[model samples]
Target: MPRDRPAPDLPEPLAPLIDAHTHLDACGATDAASVAAIVDRAEKVGVGRVVTVADDLAAARFAVDAANWDPRVYAATAIHPTRANVLDDATKAEIELLAGDPRTVAVGETGLDYYWPGKLEGCATVEEQVEGFRWHIDLAKRLRKPLMIHNREADHDLLAVLIDEGAPETVIFHCFSSDANMALACVEAGYVLSFSGTVSFRNARDLHEAAKLVPDDQLIVETDAPYLTPHPFRGAPNEPYCLPYTVRSLAHTRGQDPVELAEASTATARRVYRI
Candidate 1:
């Protein structure tokens, strides 16, 4: 992480949008006031609500805590696919307890991640990630909450497992990275696709096309903040407030009005997350 990079300036206010996924903990928010400050910046940029997501035991706990701390904040809890090796019995028990919290909106970021097995030390293998993803699917179904997935270079295996395990009623592919074909497949399967800043890059024509194909009901917009900051500020530090840039990019890509896209995505987020 580059400590010196500053957060991007607020985009032209696009009102009442939601950053469907973010990490306040990674963005240097530890306490109630810090979370509020970050959300304050977001509100000024016309992004009002945020869903803080967890990637591990500590983050899961903090995600629930942060959601409880601020009314505008909601939470999604799971051990990320890369860290699936840590999903032991006690871990599952605690996460299940957290998942039952009213502030917790979804049960994920826990699908498949084949991108880090050899490169990252202690990363889980594909097999372990698959088992963990199945457990998360069961948890989400039992709770009647949406399943939020984190797919990276494992789309084929990921989709296969979702099919084998029987997907939850609502599944959200957060920061959806596949091309138009996969997007079409997911749409056909009745899954929701939540786009992030990565879709805005000039070289991301595939994601651009994927963005254009999603129906309004199945589409969502997010920041995935502190990572994948939108273009014109791609390498800069990101926060929930940076969501508008990606929303505008999505609107431009889809050839729709920005405010209209914003409103539709906000409504979709409400329906999918029930937040």
Candidate 2:
């Protein structure tokens, strides 16, 4: 069952919010009417834009079509690391063409994930994952776009690969869950850390600490919606409308003003994604 919805409250201010990373395509939430409904709710809560990610070929087409239909929606294309084995030469060529679309802003939602062993059986081997990630990295660099990374329990290997291959012009670590040291390393490498609702959990002290350590310009916020709903609303189906709660929590951790945090994050999102 989806989580319970809490009584909605008016957000502090309707400053524009940008959900830097979200899987609108993969979550069975990418249709026009549904997308419009979600965007409307986001607009009501001050969210101005969203970068909907595609985890596979069919979804990539949906992402592009949706973005073309809605000016506020942007797209990111990549074969998710877990599904890397499915990426054939034809798929790669198609993705290259898709990446050239104006609305396709980044190249990812890709990286390594060892947490669910065998979950990607016959989908992608570790070598395939590495090769696919490197290909996307190169694509991002060539296209002069940022890369939205998803690293889950594969930080060390992921970092090593990025360092060795040299990442793209800009890299955003979405739903960052690594410890402070890894956070520091990423920051030092000139990467952006996008915090999610998980950072708002009471027991997420490590995330909070990492949030505090992240420089203002190098930080961004997201809902990773339909997942990682913020505290006080945990278990609920998350949407861009819930961003303010996560932003407020992030501000609290950094001892910054909520409005300022919102503005800075929006600007950072625009600058990074070139939206």
Candidate 3:
């Protein structure tokens, strides 16, 4: 849904934010024209770079293609935790090949998700998810790339696995919704926590607190676009251009200037994704 009115004016420096995690491939709103439109809108609000994550092989290829279509766009490839069962040998080989492409900067959106109790059709069990996660972790290590993880109600298992297996160059916990203790542990482990629009929700006081606890260097902001749109726009289809709202809210929570937050987050994003 398009905004009925223009977004509120951003401070001069906070205008050029970077959405560290988004999903153009999933949105089906990222064609040449749509990309140009999105970029234009983002630029108008100071959103400079967008990292689009692909969940499966087809989506991964689409992310690479979208990156090719726009200089400002970057791509991450992985088999999502929910779809971990689909990672057959052929698919694994294809993903391995995709990693070599320069546009493919990271491996994942892969981790564990135990929030849904029932077995999802064609979805992997926890054991299978762990195995798939390990495979992607190995690929990230071999490729010397960062890893983008997605954990939901499986923090203990996820942390245990990462600690035992070690991590790639960088491990980013995308859409970090965990509590402060886990956030602290992740920080101590040299992992980055990427906050999404969820942090802006009034009910997400815990997330706001976590944001405050996160070190500047270990913090990044994202839209997780077409998913968790920020407050005032929640439940609406999210887009990269809406990142400033989340950033603004994060800055407020952290008691930092919006421009400083933007600059720091952009730097952190670059460090993790090497974008």
Which sections of candidate 3 miss by over 4 Å?
Answer: 1-13, 117-119
- Model 1 has an lDDT value of 0.93
> How far is 39's C-alpha from truth in model 1 (Å)?
0.5
Which regions in candidate 1 have their CA more than 4 angstroms from the true location?
2-4
RMSD of each: 0.9, 1.9, 2.5
Off by over 4 Å in 2: 1-14, 26-30, 119-123
Q: Write the per-residue lDDT of candidate 3 for residues 1-275, one digit (tens) a residue.
A: 43454444433335557888888765555577787677676777888888888888888888888888899988898999888889999999988888768987888789999975375666678888999999999999999988999999999999899878888869999999988888999999999999998899999877777888999899989988878888877666677877888898889988999889998988888877777
Cα lDDT tens digits, model 2, 172-244, are 9999988898899999999999999888899987877888888878988887876888878886677777789
User: How do all the candidates rank in terms of TM-score, highest first?
Assistant: 1, 2, 3
For model 3, what is the alpha-carbon lDDT of residue 87? 91
Task: For candidate 3, report its TM-score.
Answer: 0.93
Answer with 1 or 2, whichever has the higher lDDT: 1
Worst 10 residues of 2 by lDDT: 1-10
Q: Model 1, 1-275: lDDT tens per residue?
A: 33456767778899889999999999999999999999999999888999999999899999999999999999999999999999999999999999999999999879988889999999999899998999999999999999999999988888898898899999999999899999999999999999999989999989888888999999998888799898888679999998999999889999999999999999999999897
Model 2 scores a C-alpha lDDT of 0.84
Which structure is stronger by TM-score: 1 or 2? 1
Q: Rank the candidates by lDDT, best first.
A: 1, 3, 2
lDDT of each: 0.93, 0.84, 0.84
Q: Which TM-score value belongs to model 1?
A: 0.98
